[model samples]
Target: MIVVIDTSSLLSLVRYYLPFDKKGVLFEVIKSKVSSGEIILLDAVYEESKFVGQKIILQKLDFLTDKGFLKENKVITKTDELIPLAPTRFLNMVKNQFVANPFQLKKLNESEFEVQKNRFMESADAKLIMYCQHLIKDNPEEEIYLVTEETPSANDLKLFKKIPAICGILGIPVITLPQLLEKYPEVDLGFS
Candidate 1:
């Protein structure tokens, strides 16, 4: 199974007050997944984590990032075959979803809409959906799942353009990080 992880899930390791030592355990599990060819980390997601205000989160993430970890782990980036406009095309198709999102993109003017749309265009979320779609087309036999911490929107009033919502529209199977841990029972979080 190729679990294409978003920044939400990765930062979630540090975000949810999982305690310092436990976060390390989870990070190690993530590292094992990456080493075993289970997780596909995107460069865009790593770059997008600039807004993480917590120093501890940054430090832990940096540890995974140091020593060419992503490179050595073969973290996937936007492929050359992945045209720059492809993700934008997707954003355009889902423009209504954004306009409905009162929390984030709803109050924008035309120019502001353009800028916000460009932000989504350049986001890891865009590449993630596109890549999942690409995989579905090119490798239907492969099991593709997205691991994100975002909950699937319960109503249109919420931010319906989040990764989970978009994944739902694109027919990509989605699972939460906790569900992933359940699925992989071998990872023993050794705390008594």
Candidate 2:
């Protein structure tokens, strides 16, 4: 299984699941999986996480990158063959969700919402979806999962389309931190 993790999901793990007593066990396991090429950390996610300035998150990410576990963004050379042109239906859905959602506008204001929506269009979430699609295209037998803490809003006017919603639209498999933990129950964090 190749688990593609995003910044928010990684931060959630660090903040909630990482054991205080056995400091590096969970991180080490993640690092090992990443080093073995079973896990993926996109370059964009790494850059965004660096700016978050959380000591533990930075440390873990640094360890992975330093150990060559972090991967550079995969360039889609045959994008036309692999995916539809820009302003695709998925892209339009993202844009429409942002534009029509009054809650999003109210919270971020029009200007700020536009900025954030643009950022989302270009950054981690979008890249993650593209990468997952590429992986599925190239290796249909391989199990690929996107790990994110983002959830869709029950309210009709959701300000932002979370990763799961986007992934659903793109046909990418998405899981949360708790779901990952539940699926991999053998993973010992030394919590006891």
Candidate 3:
């Protein structure tokens, strides 16, 4: 039961807005799971946490890194380690293929222009997807749940499917924050 957290869920918990908090009911549940060594976070997840509105999550990175919780494991054990899988290259290949298709690239560019403008363009989405690909590639067995707040539009949906597609190709499971939360309530998830 390796639970990989995304940035948004981490922010919610740190801000005490979501069910998982230092002392929230769900927090207790997740904390136990983490303590028992079930929940884990990817290194990129830390990158996302740095932008959380609250200071608590940002401040705890050092402690969490030291404790081998928020940070990825340096040593590759049979079960644990950061960047545990290697799906990055695979993801890049697919993304490259998508971008190479003039129709798809034009659609993505138009969508980016109409929506994100500058905040989050196709490049950013590609980067995120590439990162996910990296995760799937490196840690083939670990199940990952992307904890993002961004909802997918019809176009975005097609693009986002690359994650699950990659996971499917690699025989890995990819889910969302709430889905993981609901399924793994008994798991612990908090920093000491």
Best by TM-score: 1
Span of 10 residues, lowest total lDDT, candidate 1: 76-85
Most lDDT-accurate candidate: 1
Q: Mind giving the per-residue lDDT tens digits that candidate 3 earns over 111-152?
A: 563453223223333344444546666677766544454443
| Model 2 spans > 4 angstroms off | 21-24, 53-55, 60-62, 65-87, 97-118, 154-159, 190-192
**In model 1, which regions exceed 4 Å deviation?**
15-25, 61-63, 76-92, 102-110, 154-160, 190-192
Candidate 1 structure lDDT: 0.67
Candidate 2, residue 6: lDDT: 83
Which of the two candidates, 1 or 3, achieves a greater TM-score against the reference?
1
At residue 14, candidate 3 shows an lDDT of 54
Q: Give each prediction's root-mean-square deviation over alpha carbons.
A: 4.0, 5.2, 7.9
Candidate 1 per-residue lDDT over residues 38-78, each given as its tens digit: 88766676666656655445576564556676667665464
- In model 2, the clashing pairs are none
In TM-score terms, candidate 3 sits at: 0.49
